[model samples]
Target: MNPEKAFKYDVLINAEDLCDREFEQQDFLKRAKAKKRTIVFAPRRYGKTSLIKNVVGNSFFNLSRNHLVLFFDLMDVQSMESIAKRLHHGITQALSRRFPVKTLLKNATDYLKGFSLQMDMDPVTGQPSLSMNVKGREVENEMTHLMAAIKTLSQKYPTLIILDEFHDITFVPEAEALFRGVLQELGESAVFILGSKRHLLTLMFQDARAPLFQYGDEIHLNPIALEDWLDYFRERMTPNKIIIGEEELKWILETLCDVPNAICEFGAWLLDNIPSGMTLSVGVIKQSLDLMVENKQSYAYMLQGYTEKELDLMTVIAKNKFTLEPHAESFLKLIRVSKSTVGKIVKKFMDRGLIEYELEKGYRLSDPLMGHYLATR
Candidate 1:
């Protein structure tokens, strides 16, 4: 097998595996190690998860010996039970990493008061893991107990917990309140690192009445710049004897809106297609992009649910490529919709997660490629 095949240009879960975002990594490291609460948010696919993991991993190495790091991914959690299970899993994972299995097993009950812990060994790896259950019967009871457990654990050890895709908690009323209350109760001893999709995340922190309002310092993750992409690609391609020119690299970045995931995926595609000892060119880039669009028929399928006005507005959005004033006379005229109709359409788009609007930034489509699909298809 070719060793280069192991290289990934996909979703990165660890910081050590990523090539850029040095600024974000350092900022998070400093704040988190200081035990300051921080919230790291970005649009989907902007590599927020990888950044947090990198910072968390670094903290374990650099922070005071008494501190423990815990990561809970709330992406797949839907109900109180599931969230409890994930928290249980996260706490166990952190404990397993820090203390011996025998020690954790002996002390788990004392460390986590409200929840019961059962220790077992992995048959293959022979590593000990724990399962948690509340002393009570219902999920709410379990969650209440879990919160108690977290409170107890936080007081005992200085802990940092990263809640990835935390915005999903909005779906469950009880879970959101319980989690927030716990964080409030725990105070400075437990620092939370939250990750979420930008739209929902915005609502959580920006809405004054929300439980997570003013929860922590908000750090927005933006696109990795062109020069960073160039440096990264040049280094990755060097081992394969392939080189991409400055202009060629710029075109790719421009085409992909400088999104790191797209840039990495497109670069990998180029590596697979370009012959060794050859310089990649504009034509090759266009051809690869065309192939990618052709394969993404699902983008078209996604538009099937939108009204004609919504689709027209999307096309205009793609063409303008900036925050849009959909209510403006020119935009309404171009889309041929009335002012009242435009407001409804914008809200509809926002509700469906296809678009977003802010006073400062106007309106934006969530995915850049989705705009490309609308403009061309």
Candidate 2:
């Protein structure tokens, strides 16, 4: 294997580059085929985006050839107008990928009547790029039109609309109710997949009072099994003549809490820093982890946003690993906060993805690397 083609770690893993999620890929595709609306919940950096892209990418399920897969990320969307623009762009981009520029413009004109469409060539990829723009103060009406257009287009082409980080939609007033209404109107004409962080997504879909409650089948993406990771590492490393034993692999996985992105970062670090035919050692692993922590120095600044009490509580949680008894006398003494205050701060931390709770493990820092950083600092 070429050195350039060795183990790669990217923000977005390509379909073919995915490690192991065969079961999830199949399950997601199954739901899409049934036209069932689905909601996926996962921790940050747990490969939720990668799984969705891999399932829909041409090299995998090949849904793009026959189905119009419109993917939009609602992350940090502040207004209804911004959402309208994102929807328009996603629709046009998905159409362009499926149909030729000329045909897409001609066929989509009726469906996208209100929006101005422009065709441009991407300088880097030399591919046709479509841009959609609409101007108006009536953002809500524009959203309604977009949904109506989606319903009409779905009749011709089987459609799959993915809204990633969809919890951010809460920022815009009445966005959830609007979406629920549109979803009801579309019925089985389209399949929708909504993805978000576990904490926020759960509140949106599980709260009885929420408009989107029980709106879709829910799926949670868990960490890849250690056995699978070991096999994947061995296969990838053997080709490059790099040696890593199972014990060292397990240690790395445990250190990163089996987060796929973090593990891939470690692998990429090894491929770049270590020489071929050299066995991975504990010392080298420690260095890689330290380097990773150093690379994530920006994470520390996130602390500035919290209150002093919140910071103290977080520090306690990080140092202890997982606290089963957060309200215990000793825990409360450490944070110097009342029991009620501890509850509020813990809820806030959980809401922000700073901490997670397991039935057996209690509360722990969501990012284990952050735990190491907090411990040392």
Candidate 3:
């Protein structure tokens, strides 16, 4: 493979080349084949999306080549209409993948009756785009119809529906109940894979009072193992004569917090900027890391979005790495905030995906690079 295309940092990793996740892939496939619902919980940049794509692309549950896979990104969803529109488009795109435009229109005409579906040529790509419009008071009805269409399609084909960033559904009132109703209705006709950040996703499924409590098997994604990273690094770099030792590779993983995307970014950076001899020394590696941190300066504006106390509390957490006790007297003194204030700030940042809590590590910045940047800057 071309070195330029070998490291995929900004996009989904190719199915064949995706590293690690062997256990996850097999577990997910087994559940999917058995038509079990799954909730995937992970921090951002942990390759949740790539993992799902790989499973579907490679296995397809050993089903027909035309099995349908629908992906809906529910990020920042604010209203019922937004949910309805996303579902409508996701169903349409999934069908398009299986059938030609004419067949899609002909078949969907019956499957999607009563919904105003349109097929138009995209101005930018000149490709056909299919969409459904949800109007005024009919938003709820449209959402119901969309879910029904999913059930109908699943009965005829092996189907997988993925809702990415599903935690954003909380923005819409009673959305959880709405989804629970749909899940109860669907049964084994389809497999639903819901992905979201760890903390919020856990609460949604584990809190008994929540509507989606115990709805599916929950899988929490952790960092890729160091041995797997070593193998992947050697395979990708050795081909291009890029010389990086195992120790240096392990340091890169630790420095980047074992986030697959960031590690790939580092690899891509090395490929683009390594010396002509293709040797990566400690000084060069450190310089590369420094440059990566410097490039994150744009994220400094996020600090401005918080209040003074929030910023101070974040700084304390970032610098200290993790705080076992945010309300402890010494920790509170460092941030110069009351326990109540710290509690509110921690919750706010956690919700915003800036902070995360580990059972052993307590509270820390969700993105370690952001922590490093905050500590230095």
Q: Candidate 3: deviation at residue 186, Å? A: 1.9
Name the TM-score of candidate 3.
Answer: 0.90
lDDT of 2 by residue, 187-268 (tens): 6553545554556777788889877788887877777887888777877777768898888888998777777877887787
Best by TM-score: 3
In lDDT terms, how accurate is model 3? Answer: 0.75
The reply for model 3, stretches above 4 Å from the true place, is: 1-5, 134-137, 278-284
User: Sorted on lDDT, highest at the top, how do the candidates line up?
Assistant: 3, 2, 1
Score residue 180 of candidate 2 by CA lDDT. 77
lDDT of prediction 1 = 0.72
Select the stronger candidate by lDDT from 1 and 3: 3
Off by over 4 Å in 1: 1-7, 61-66, 121-126, 208-212, 297-320, 332-362
Residue-wise lDDT of candidate 3 within 114-165, one digit each (tens)? Answer: 6666788989988887776544357778887787787777777777767888
Per-residue lDDT of candidate 1, residues 125-197 (tens digit): 8877777766778877777777777777777887776788787776766777777788788675536555535
Q: What residue runs in model 2 are displaced by over 4 Å at the alpha carbon?
A: 1-5, 57-65, 123-126, 189-192, 239-241, 281-284, 301-307, 324-328, 358-360
